[model samples]
Target: MTTGALPTQTLPELPRHDHGGCINKAIQIAETLCNDRGVRLTPIRRKVLELVWESHRAVKAYDLLDRIKPLETSAKPATVYRALDFLIEQGLIHRVESLNAFIGCNCSDHQHELLLLICNRCQEVEERPALEVMNAVAKEIAEAGFHVHRKAIEIHGLCAQCAALELVR
Candidate 1:
């Protein structure tokens, strides 16, 4: 419950980086978490998670269904949605409400409040532990006697890499 604001930060995968490591790390974490929680990460669910982690960009449900169909020929809209719902419940992924899309949660090893920085140009989504901002919002909710089941702040803009590219143009 530390309430310190984070300084402005850049997307960790920006510019140029080896993204294959990202996929591997995320999958490994998901497997460990599932085993620790005694929850079964079924084949379909694992596939959906892999597809979502294919990039940092937010992915829509239908898009996920489409991508998964080739691998999981039995996949349907309902199948994808169910897997998504489970992933969100387990804190393995997040729904970007404004964008109506989903993004993999990098901090799935622990529970935390997050802020999503979405780049309009590159369609990449970065997750941040914006503790101070979430604390403020919690205080406001308490004052209003409101109960929040879930909370995430999403801000859309150009990520550092995209902004630098803009300058060059």
Candidate 2:
């Protein structure tokens, strides 16, 4: 009932578009961008991106490899890792440091900071746009003579649905 809260009723999944379309479009867009930037969107690399975009949940590399099993059959560990590195450099995905996992990004065009809201109980991860908060933090750090080259902001807590369920119990 409160703001930023989901109802107590358990939902199988969050609101999602047609996954087939989502993945396909994401691939097309990423490929287009890579072409524009003169980056190589190799077959293995494209497969990795597809695997990450298969779900909204955080996906570990091992699991990603498993999902893209065909790629694993041909590509070695180094190959997959290198493909992941390329995708990361291109900003096609976001890495969840706490979970040691990767997730496809909704923000594919522009660059911005992300605040991860991870559920301690269910481990559901939500990405909240964190421009203002990160900006403020950066300003404070700058005043303290600190500079940040990279940031993976994670705020762990119960999700709204979990909180509602707890209240009911």
Deviation from native of the Cα of residue 21 in model 2, angstroms: 3.6
lDDT of 1 by residue, 57-83 (tens): 888888798788888888888988999
The deviation in Å at residue 110 for candidate 2 is: 3.4
Give each model's whole-structure lDDT: 0.82, 0.75
Model 2 lDDT at residue 81: 83
Listed in order, each prediction's TM-score against the native is 0.87, 0.80
How far residue 10's Cα lies from its native spot in candidate 2, in Å, is 15
Query: Which tens-of-lDDT digit does each residue in 1-169 have in candidate 2?
Result: 3333233244335545698887887898898889899988988898889888876667778877776766568777778888888888888888888778777875665564778887654556777777888788878888999777777688877789777766887
Worst 10 residues of 1 by lDDT: 1-10
Model 1, runs deviating above 4 Å:
1-14
Q: What lDDT score is found at residue 9 in candidate 2?
A: 40
